[model samples]
Target: MGTAATDDAGSATRALIFALVALACGHMLSTLLRTIPAISLDLMAADFHIEPQALASLTSVYHFAFAAAQIPVGAAMDRFGVRPVSLALLAGTVFGAVASGFATGPESFAVGQLMLGVATSGMLMCPMTLAAKQLSAARFGLWSGAILSIGNIGMLLSSSPLAFVVDTWGWRAGFWISAAGGVVVALAVFALVPNQPAEHKDHSSPMAQMIEVLRLGLSRPLRGLIALALVSLASSLVLRGLWGGPWLMEIKGLTRVEAGNQLGAFTLAMIVGPLLIGMIDRRIGRRRQRGCREHSTDRRRHIERAGGGSLRRTDCALDDGGHGSVVAPRAGLVLSGRAFRRPSPAIAGDRCRRSDPQLHELLRFAGRRC
Candidate 1:
């Protein structure tokens, strides 16, 4: 019985890893879709004779599609399992890639990019959901981080490596390669990932559930986080996904390869940032609350006392029950250079383990400007 149990555990672990890897591939493609335009925009623009305004619209279409898909994807995931939903959507990525490879005009390219965005929407969320169902809560963060790190590898590849490909083989070839890889990733996901049953048996209409979720979001406590997330993420996407490369090449006067290398630093930070944060969060554990609070308060006080300038609207997130623990609000300052508004006293009283060590590192990295 002991031997049998060990064998079974090993099998499950392998299966879990396999599923994560397949999902990671999807995520990798997602990142590639986002980053490719950064590196290949010049080539694409030249090929299609795209004007500046059209180029901007073409790229933004992906984000538009991606954001629009979230609610419908969530509903589909609830009705179907992760496996089928993910696989089906992933095919969109493949289609988009191939279509873009052969695109003759800006309009066609935009359609392909939109399809890519829609198809790859489930990449990260579905895997995390799968982990929640299959693994322990303690392991969920680690696995999610792993999956994100793997996706960052795609971002990394889309930088200097993709630049090399575009330089040598032309940008169209790059799209074809991505399309082929997407097919392989889809097949792997289909074969290896097991179907997960719906977590909620409520059988409520998806529209109703979506409406309820939106209603819950109307709560005051969630507003600041939502606002912070939207503003910061939107700006980052505009920079990284759209204009970063042009700025580096034009303003900074860097070569294409050099620009790609610089962007690689951003991607590298993304890859390492979460892992380091997770480690810090884990180590700080319960100490996060009292220690982080004291440290932040005293540090801010000292800085101002020492003439460091008045601290901006620095906010700390106290824990809340029911929902998964959000990183302490101070982390937002560290990560995004913006402090969130503190939650209400009622919301703050609900406690969870502290996760501020990672925030400290982010603060330290970002410097006092945040």
Candidate 2:
């Protein structure tokens, strides 16, 4: 039994390592889809004689293709299995990269970017799906987060390193190098990835499934979140993918390398944002707990001394928005008051009963002060 358990653990470890390696390649390539234009925008504009608006639209076609491909790619993963779908997509991306490098005009370059976007759409999803299958549910989130963080290194590379490459060998040479790297990744994926099928097949077609998700799965709150994500992600992609380098160079009066360095700093901040937010969230939770306990204890002692009787403890809880009401008693009446916090307006008003007119007035005055 022990030997069998040990063997199983070893196998799982190996599978996890392989899955990460395969995903890393695809993720790095996907980052290139976002970063290539940032580093090479000037070269592209000059090469194709395109204006700023035209250039933005051309590069944005990548995001358009990526968004459009999601449903079909998810369906492909469900029905055809991950390995084949991923291989096909990654190969298309490689082909697109090489074609873009060799593109003679704007039309060809646009087509290449569209293909690249379509191919790279499944890069992150395929790996996540594979990880879900390979690891336990409890471990999935941890492993997936680690994989994504590692993949961000590609974004880092696309900054100063990419600038150096483009400066030394030219932008076209950079794409050619990426194509070569894609080939190497493709081989690694081919050898490492298995044809893992969905655990339960959804008989619905891709479009049908997508419609169902929109109708049933997306609640009002979820829809709001999706809209928020759309705005934020759109801004990030537009800035990092197209405008950042140019803005830095033209407006900020920085060299290409300096702009790249600034972009890298921006990417680093993005990477750290979630961690900082998480830490702050935990701290806020702890403070809220401590505040609640101390407030309850102090209020209860005051109420007991004033009323000359014991007070019953009532449960008070914050809503999702982190606002709540505290209930306590003073003399012969009950007092309900609210408190405010950051990110939302505070509550300060209080309500009391006329059972004790004088006490009610005093509590009302205290509430106003509170």
Candidate 3:
């Protein structure tokens, strides 16, 4: 009997691991979708008949919508189970990818970004809330690291691979492929994640959960953390997603392919950071708060603080640094210097020539005169 019980426990552990992996893939998809614009901003702007800066600024809507959705998405997870909420978000994500892929103008593209924002807002939390509920601190620490490592693969994908796809097939192809990836991820979640009941016993209305999240954001404990997240993450997102590729290509005189290679290499350290920390946390393991009652506020705070200590990257949406990440992209234009924003009329005319031969010739002649 003892052997049989041990086997069952092992089976359950394997199943949970599989489920978290599937959910983490959703986070990967989120990373891929959001960062694609970074490598191909110029291409997207040319296609949309706008300046690169405009498109970079416009894309901030995705982050805003992402931040705003955190409240309702959290509430939905509380009222409904993580699996259902995740599945719904995945479906929405696929739909948004398709919409973004087919967009004919900036208006349509922004609509798609808004959809993606709402859809992907909850992805990091699904695997996280589940692990936080089920695993001991040591176990959760290890798994959280694994989940982040998986998600960082998305940024890696967006870098060189996406740049190649954009250069060869155009920016639309990138979104089309991502849409297909989203479908695959959804199927994996549907198959691997079991139909579990809502683990949170919050009888409070969904509205209450939403309100509570806002309240906590303002509360003293989290305020400084939130601001620090803002400054650090905002700069990183803007640098990586908004200006890094362009800066390299425009200022450093590197080819798009070369720029992609450098950017891709730069992300390697981030992918590994979490695993190292998780290893240390596992070495300094904590006792069980895995099945502790959340009937009391103190226990809830204890788990939030303790879990956040090592696993903050599970990214609590707000903690994901949404506000700052989006807001900082515009500032990137200023910091990157003048070459990118105005891009000498010659360069603009050269890019515009793809769609208009006459204008390209005119710009070339005009460039000689200047």
Candidate 4:
């Protein structure tokens, strides 16, 4: 009987991991879609009768939309649960990707980008929330890294492979392919992610909840950290996903393939660097000081500060956006992974009584045994 029970537990763990990975692939799709314009900006601009820089700047709308939607998306996941929210987003992504592929004008493409931005804003959070609520902190930490590592793989695909596709079939092929991928991921989520509701639901109006988040974030004590996160996130996205290609191709006079290769190398480093820092963190048990000294770690993760917490506990932003852009993906998984230490005794009591679901959720992620 005992052996059979162990086998059952192992099977459940496997199923849970499959669901987690499928959800993580949504994060991959998010990165892939967001960065698509980087490689093909010139072509897209020419097709739309505009300057390449204009098209590049227009892509910023997507990022703005993405950032804005994260505020509501987290609440939706909390209220409606991750599985439903993920399915809805995946559906939107598929439609948006296909529409973008079919777009013949700048206006249509902009509309498509907006849809995609909102749809994919929570891709990382979906998986992160799932792991946070379902598993022990240790397992959640391991899986969090896995989520980052997997999600960034989309950037890798967007690099050389996407360049090749653009050269051969024109840039539209990328979106069509992504649409297909979205359908596949959606099916996987439907099949694998458990259909359970959130353990603690917040039934309050979303606007009130959002107001609470904004108020907390903008409060005097936390505003500095929020400002720092915003600065760090925007710079990294613009650097890696926007101008990096133009610099390589136009300024350096490299071929498209060559530029993709260069970006691929840098992205590979982006994927590997964080986990290395995280490992050193584990060994020495002192990452916060180093994180501050380097000024190149995850601000949100630092804010969490849970003892032995998962590496880079993040929320209300895209996964990569939550980390130090330089070393974002590389360190996510030795295998997969909060810095928010437990609340103070006074704050902890308030958290239990408050309807501010994020605070309640935050407290639940406190590091504990499986």
Candidate 3's residue-wise lDDT over 21-135, tens digit each?
9999999999889988878888889989999989988899999999899879877886788889999999999999999999999999999999999999998888877776677
**All models: lDDT?**
0.69, 0.65, 0.73, 0.73
**TM-score of each predicted structure versus truth:** 0.76, 0.71, 0.75, 0.80
All-Cα superposition RMSD per candidate: 10.0, 17.8, 20.5, 9.3
Candidate 2 residue lDDT tens string, 1-370: 9999999999979976886668767887788656877877887788888876687778877888988988778767767777888889889988989888998888998888888889899888777777665654335545555566656667777888888888888888777877887888888888887656655356877777566445521532233334334443554575677788887888779888999998999778655653343334433544324434544554565444334445532312212231111222121111111121121113222322323222222222211111
Q: For candidate 1, lDDT tens digit of each residue in 193-232? A: 9876776536788898677556544545444445555544
lDDT digits (tens) for residues 1-370 of candidate 4: 9999999999999998999999999999999998888788888888999898888777877888898998888777767889999999999999989988998988889888889999999998898888887776445555666677788889898889988999899899999999999999999999999998876576689887777767765644343344445554565577568777777888779888888998899788767764454334335544334434444344334434322244443343334364344343223211011121223454444544474545544433322111
Sorted by TM-score, highest first, which candidate order results?
4, 1, 3, 2
Backbone clashes in candidate 3 total 0
* Candidate 2: residue 87 Cα off by (Å): 0.6
Cα miss at 233, model 1 (Å)?
2.2
**Model 2 error, position 72 (Å):** 0.8
